[model samples]
Target: MIVMNRFARRAAYFLIIATTMGAVLCTRVLTSVHAQATAPTTDKAVAIMDPTLISRGEYLAKLGDCAGCHTAPKQGAPFAGGLAMGSPFGTIYSTNITPDRQTGIGHYSYAEFERALRDGVAPGGKRLYPAMPYASFTKISDADMLALYAYFMHGVLPVSNRPPETMLPFPFSQRWGLFFWDTAFVRHERFKQDDKRDAQWNRGAYLVQSLGHCGACHTPRGAGFEERGYDESSRLYLTGGANDNWFAPNLTGDLGSGLGRLSPHDIAAFLKSGHGAAVHIVTFGSMVQVVEDSAQYFTDDDLNAIAHYLKSLPAREPSGAYNPQSQKAQEMAVSLKTGDVEHPGAGLYLAFCAKCHQTDGRGVLQKFPALAGNPTVLALDTTSLLRLVIEGGASPQTLNGPPTRKMPAFANQFTDAEIASVLTFVRTSWGNEARPVAKRDVAVLRGKLKK
Candidate 1:
């Protein structure tokens, strides 16, 4: 009787949600039809595809990192899609953006492209998932949108690659449900210039908030999975967020886990080469892809602007601090030289880590990233660190950057408890003051990685 009652309750709950979503969807359809019918048609002249426009579009595409998502690794042609993006609901495969009539956006008009990029509504009323980052793309200016369209239509090579269909389960599978999601969460506004701010800052803001979509990864999400804040207007903007098991650390002016320690030039250099010489920090995880595919190609002026904008953001929810002359750091250095394995993970650090990351936790410049004050090491969330240690990672290969340096995995070398202890030691020692990593935390992550 209890099991039956529980099943009945579950059914009723689903019914309520389904009924609400259906009603909302129907209302949206009617409203959309009416809006389209009533909307005045304008016969705007299409601009001639000049070299300059096409070149700008190509640059914009890189800035947007369109290839990052659309180009499936070792599988699909550039922008031919088939990339499987894992979401909370299920796997959402990227659609082919190449100019292939049957399989891509070849049939899409500028209007259709605009709607899809800005409003998340594709042709035939097909709703794109938020995984597309249209919310941020919506801020792109009219001129920039035109350039992007021109590039996609004329500059890019067409491929008739039909990527796998993304069929998420039940409620999430219902594309119409996103109508309400858009209405409530998406801010349908173009990039607005701040009269008070300089052109450089505004340009940086436009690129970061719109084409760059840095906030898509850096900004925290709300209950509906909407970005908590779009720009610097809200305190939560760029304070850090996790995506695909890696934590994109805070980009605000927080001394420990943010860009606070680095100068504007350092930030620009980091974007260009994936190495911040000022702080001895290097890109890891998904950021390596960004640097390789997008940021490395950015013009010097634009990189500086981005760096300036990031530098301007005030600190929020600050945690962790680094001091090179701390007593703990001194003691650790002494212990390492004296063969004292007194500290919990000191012996392991000497045996495994000290060779690359020096006894003092400072790494080789432009080769291995320093562990002492590295933002990834001091981040509140230990997911990235844990994964990096267990699974290993490589530095991005860039036009000007050093040859890619690989970190070896220790999954088989150490036990979960040992991993946790080493991480905890690293986090706390060498003037890095962050929380400890528990054995359970390491075990949970390891188990997840296995599957």
Candidate 2:
């Protein structure tokens, strides 16, 4: 009996070892296949050094906002890729896209580059994190992709700077898991024009959904961290989302919290100039980067089409709107004129914000953005407000016009509590009924900006 028991125990131990080994082997095989599957089997002379193609590539790259993320602040080389982007899991560093033979993408063939853009697959079947926005880039046209490849390979000056490696924790660190994520969430498809829509609408849809990758920041994410909606059919599409401590306000035609009041021309003008000519609206926070880098470069027709498409989104009405004649407005007016000796926020607002924004909270037309009736001010998310207050910014400079003015960065000037108070005061006053800003929120953004 003792001998039999010993043999059984030994058998059980061997079984456990076999199972573990099988798991490891399976993971390795799957990961290998995932990486290799997207790699081109044959080398082809796919790209030619044509100036026109290179110029087109440059335009496409601008549309893709490549430099905004790929170039680190104060970095010497563009696309040398040392920018540190914060994600829910961890900090992910952008990779070098410059065509340097050693550290950059000089070694990447056209096929590899295309695969990386469209499939999120790096060379050797390595899966890139979704932060790369390949989910949206997958919809770019084959022709555009070709041009982009030529630009990166031949037009761009190669840089050898290697960014810091990304280090994620535990399961996230294992890139094999990203394979399943891709299969479930990513659509490896090209843009298809809808026959029912006009050419202009289709063009708008393509730009918004694909090359522009607007949903990357604007759309809310599902439980799996994928965008809740990629197409306009879904209600969650372009309804707004908070990313990296800034809230991208709703692009939908929601009356109170979205762009319902803005006309198609107004929207187009905003895109072209980063501020509406008629409305007292200006780009602030993270959107400043988007406008400066991408939107300002859009062609006139494309801008109009984008505006038309966005304005066509169904309007969402707020349950209630704040009254302009509220007690809060009266209090703010008193504070602005005489300075609220009791409230620190009022004093700060009057001192720092009253000049450009005006004492009445109606900013100078086409110069300063109005605080009153502003969608961003009244949105449920206060991140944008806090971000703007902490990191003062300017509107995008267009070919025809620059920003009327720039707001100085107040990060060092105000304490977290002070910033929170001022933002809260702004939101509460001037008929805006959004929630009060918290010190914690200001602190978080301040910390991130410092980093």
Model number with the top TM-score: 1
Error of 2 at 245 (Å): 1.2
TM-score of 1: 0.92
Backbone clash pairs for candidate 2 read 35-125
The estimated TM-scores of all candidates read 0.92, 0.83
Summarize candidate 2's per-residue lDDT along 198-217 as a digit string, tens digits.
98899899989998899999
lDDT of 2: 0.79
Candidate 1 residue spans exceeding 4 A from truth: 1-48
| Whole-model Cα lDDT of every candidate shown, in order | 0.86, 0.79
Q: Which stretches of candidate 2 lie over 4 Å from their true place?
A: 1-47, 316-345, 397-399, 409-418, 438-451
